[model samples]
Target chain A: MFVAWRDLRTAKGRFALMGTVIVLVTLLVGLLSGLTAGLARENVSGVTGLPADRLVFAEPPDGRSPSFSDSAVSEGQWRSWARRPGVVDAAPLGVRTTEAAAAPGSGGGTGGGAARVAVAAFGAEPGGRLAPGGLAPGRVVLSARAAEELGVRVGDRVRLGPGTAAVAAVEGDASHAHLPVVWTALQDWRRLPGAPGGATVIALTTGEGFTAAASEAADEALGTTALTVDEALAAIGSYQAENGSLQLMRGFLFAISALVVGAFFTVWTVQRAPEIAVLKALGASTGYLLRDALGQALLVLTAGTLAGTALAAGAGLLIGRSEVPFAVEPATVLVPAAVTVVLGAAGAALSVRRITAVDPLTALGSAR
Target chain B: MTLLLDDVTLTYEDGGGRLTALDRVRLDVPAGTVAAVVGPSGSGKSSLLAVAATLIAPDRGRVVVDGADTAALDRGARSRLRRERVGIVFQQPNLLPSLTAAEQVQLMAHLSGRPPAAARDRARELLAAVGLAGEADRRPHRLSGGQRQRVNIARALMNDPAVLLVDEPTSALDHERGAAVLDLLVGLTRERGTATVLVTHDREHLARADRVLTMRDGRLTGA
Candidate 1:
């Protein structure tokens, strides 16, 4: 990088402009990545956080995707799944979004008015791990968000359908389809108004001997489809559409970054044609020239990406706690920065190929 | 032992027809001598230097630098020959604007894959030889015209090339600076035993050449 290094030092203005562009693009992509992960968490953390490795839904007719909104697992299917070989445990889990009103003299009474919180309620049977407090019939566990919204604590009664269940505990801040969770018994869940179906889906834990044959037997017996945890994410309708659009936007950002880099280096290569000719005449090989050019690009890209990543991470930390859904995992921040650098280098590589075609003979008279 | 061009004929495609730049031109310069090629505009002086420097292959001629025939060599081989054996001082003082005077000369060593530290002493010596010892750290834009041209000359010889090909080295300088450059070329040719070919249109600097060759209409005379 004899000339490349010196050019970078001497031509600071040009490279600064290019580096600014890279930084801004990386910042935009990184922020979007965080938001995408945060929003996705809100959409599917309920299913993803399940103790079972897989969830079984009532099979739609042939050639259709599984849908949580459309699935309703019956008791016969749950009993059949419990008897299947290689099935360590099968638990019936019901899910419904409904309005719940806290007891009049509970924490809701502090304001002297009823506090009705919208929550996604889950139902499981007695002795099943899905049950809130080990089959205490009238006890319910509320997620932190749900508890906060309803202004109820333990030993307080919250009305579900026609019955009032005592709050057992306020657990982790888990969400389902953008709403907080409220756990109740499966029988009590069925009794809730507007919850016409018995159970939404069946959560399954499979042993090591699990096989396709076992799956087929369970599916036939249960009359439900089986999906890995990852596959079940598509069952959430909003998650699919929202994640798809965010991913598409992220893809477009990557492409645009590449194009912007390509355009900048194309002009830079053209501007450096004379220098290339002189170097060629000075016996600099095509390979050496390319390495020098790409090394210069890597230096600039790495600097710009790191700066952008740090800025984005700081911004995410500031806003993640707020209402905006922004997740700041290593995968969310570092991956996009890495992609930007690789794609930008690839773009610059395409432009620097013009170096090989420069005629050293031109340097004899053209070097002015 | 220096430079030899044997019956070289170079042509170029011009407007769907062949325009001959050098027609069967033969030239030679032994070691420790300077041969200047003077011509009017478009008289193939630059073409002759280009062929001798191995930047262009002649249509029908052999270019022999230090007993190696470049016509039979591959592109890589030709570039290697140029790197190790041939040196060209361009028409313009084509110093990379980013490098200082010493760095410009040291770059020649870097191109040949030599360690930069190993080349530093030699770069300083060459710059001193060209009377640029004090301006070694000055970039091209900061140096005077004469100093930049001298740096250009120092860069060309840093590789210890057997044949030195100079093209219009004094084009951008005044007479005093041009004379100084010409004298430096003549002195370097004598001291280093390099066969030097200096291409120029200026008649005043002809006295520095051991032999002066004039070209007209793509033919050489008055050698």
Candidate 2:
């Protein structure tokens, strides 16, 4: 990379311009990745945090996908799954979005005043693994955010629809459809107005004998749709649409980065065509020239990506301290940086391949 | 003979037909001597130099450089041959703008897989030999036209190639600078014992060569 190194040093302004573009693009991609992951966590953390391996939903009508808002599984379905071969356990789970407020005349009221907040009510059996803490008839488990919003801790009374329950425990920062979760007893959940008769879905755990075919056969016979814990996240309508849009934006950013890098190197290679022919005539092999060019590109990409990732992580750290959800982990930071480098290198490689076609004879008598 | 072109013929696809660039051209240059070829603009002098440098393969006949037959070699082998045995001085100095004069000369050694320490020393020695000792660290934009051409000559000789093909080295210089460059070329040819082929349009500098040849219409006559 003797010539390549010198070229970069000699053409500082040009390369700096290109490098700045990469850094900005990488920064955008990194922040978007963090935001996407953060939003997804808020949308489905309640479902994803369940201890069950799979979820069984009441099958929708023809041509409709299963949805958390639309699915309603009865006690018969949960009992059938619990007794099926290879099934270790099955528990009924209900999900509903509603308002929760501090009960009046209770010591847990915020500043001795009433406070109301939106919450996702999850119903489960008293001792089921699907509940974070044990549920009881007159007590509820409030997620960290729900407890904070309602100003109610353990032993504090909170009013649900038509009833009031003490906060049995406050644990985890789980949410569903962007609302904090509040775990209640199945009996208490059904007492709410317009609540489902039985449960929203059935959480299940299967042993080794539960093959894919068996699961399919069981789904057909029981009139339900079975999905793995991860796959069931799509059942949240808001999560599907929001996550899809963010992912599409991220995809477009990647494509734009590749195109921008490709365009920069295309013009650079064209400007150096005469020099390339001269090098070829001087007996520089095609492989040597290619390696030199690619090495230069990698150096630029690595530097720019590192800088961009560092900046994004710094920004995410500051943003995370506020109300906005922004994650600053390796998956959010390093993965985007790596993708940027690899894609930028690929773009550069395609552009520099034109070096192979430059005719060495042109360097003989042609004017520079 | 260190460089021998045995009845080489080359043609190019011109429009719908073939244009004969070199027709049955033969030339020989022994070691420690210079042969000058003078020609009109399109008389194929550059073609002969290119053929001798292994930059272009002839349609018929063989190109022998330092006892190796280039026609029998593949593209990679030909490139290796050029790196090890042939050196070409282009019509324009064509110094890379990013490289220093010393780096320009050192690049030849790098291409041949030489050690950096040795290549650097050799490059300095060649630059001094071409009388650019103090100008080694300067880039092409900082040097004069004649100085740049001298760096070009030093670069071509850095590999100590057995065959040196020079193309209009003095085209961009005036009479005094051109004559001085020609004198330097002749002296270096004899001093390094390289078989040199110098192609030029000017007849005034032919006296410095051991032999002079003339080309017209793809044929050579005077020697």
Candidate 3:
């Protein structure tokens, strides 16, 4: 990288221009990655955070893709799952979105006065691991966001359906389908409008003997789609369409970044043809030239990506502090940056291959 | 003889016909000898250098550098031989713009996979020999035409190649600088005990050559 380093130092303007492009592309990818993860978290964190490894949903009609809105796991199906071999636990988790309002005289609980906020109401067995405070009849555990929206705390009353339930406690900030979750008993959840009488899905904890074949056998018998937590993300209708578009955009960005970097290096190598010929005529091997060129590209890509990543991380931290959903994990930030560098290098490699074809005899000022 | 070109013939395809560049040329340069080849434009001076440097394989016959037959070597071996035993100073200064005068010489060591640190002392000595001691750190653009050409000359010697091939080294320099460059080439050839072949159009530098060969119409004749 000796010549590569000197080249960078001497030709600062050309590399700087290309470096700036890489930085901007990386920044765009980083921000989008964070937003995609954050939005995805808001859409499925409630279901994903469940204690079970799999969520068993009622199979969609006519073999179409399964969806949370369309699934309604009957009580019999969950009981059968609980009795199945290798099934450690099968907990019924009901989910639905409904209006939430503060109770009168209990922490801004004015009926007809306080705003009614839409919330995803999740119901599990009273002592289930998901909604911890034992969801009893006429009582509910409100997620922090749900409680904040309703202006109510513990021991306060919030309206669910026609009747209201006393808030047992404000627990985690679980959400689903972009709405904060309100945890209630199965009985109380039945009263909410548009909620099926049975549970929405059955959360299953499988033993070591569990396998995809066994899961499929059980699903076929019980008329359900048994999917792991990550796989179940596609069951969310909005999540599928929204994430697909964003992901397509991300893919295009990666491709564009690779091509852009490749094109830049192509022109750069062409412009340095004379110098390359001179080096070759002076006994520089093709491999040496390739390494020098690639090293320069790698250095530029790494510097640009790191700077962009740091900037993106700072932006994510700032955004995470606000109400906007933005994830800043390794998968969301570092992965994208790494992919950009790898793809950019691949592009640069393709461009610099032309260096190998340069005729060393050209340096003698004549053609053979 | 360290650099030998035996019955060498090279031709180029042009418009469904072949134009000979070097026609059955035979040359040999023993170590510590300076051989000058003088020719006009298109007179096959560069072609002879190209063949001797192993940049191009002759159509017929062989190039033996440092007693190793280049015809038996592969592409990779040819390049290695060039780096290890052959040095070519291009017609133009052709210094990489990014490198300083000293670094231009150091680049040869880099190409040969020798440590830059190991070559630095030698590079300094060579640069001083070419009168570029103070201008070692100055890049090509900052150096005058003569200085860059001198750097080129110094770079070619850094590898201690057995065969040194110089192509029109002073073509781009003024008469005084050209003469100085020619003198440096002749003096280095003898001091380094290298087999030297200098190709040029200028007749004035013929005095410095141990033997002068005039090339015309794809043939060489002793002068």
Which model scores highest in lDDT? 2
User: Could you estimate the TM-score for every candidate?
Assistant: 0.95, 0.98, 0.97
Q: Which tens-of-lDDT digit does each residue in A295-352 have in candidate 2?
A: 9988988898998999999999999999898888999999999999989999999999
- Against the native complex, each candidate's DockQ, computed on alpha carbons, is 0.54, 0.60, 0.77
The TM-score each candidate achieves on chain A is 0.94, 0.97, 0.97
The digit string of per-residue lDDT tens for model 1 on A91-144 reads 989888888888778877443368677788888886686665534678888888
lDDT of 1 by residue, B159-196 (tens): 99899999888889998888889989999999999999
Ranking by DockQ: 3, 2, 1
lDDT of 3 by residue, B1-223 (tens): 8988898999998789999999889899999999999888898888898888888998898889999998999888998898888888878878888888888888888777787688888899999998989999998889998888888888888889899998888889999989988888888888889999998788898888999998888898883
lDDT of 3 by residue, A1-368 (tens): 88889989988999999999999999999999999999988898888888889999998989588888889989999999988888999998888888989877777777579788999888888876655774788899888988888889898888888788998988887889999999898878888888898999999998988888989999999999899899998988888988999999999999999999999999999999998888787777888899989999999999999988888999999999999999999998999999999999999999999999999878878655
Worst 10 residues of 1 chain A by lDDT: A107-116
After TM-score superposition, the amount by which residue A258's alpha carbon in candidate 3 deviates from its true location, in angstroms, is 1.4
User: RMSD in Å for candidate 1, one decimal?
Assistant: 2.3
> Model 2: clashing residue pairs?
none
Query: What's the lDDT for residue A260 in model 3?
Result: 93
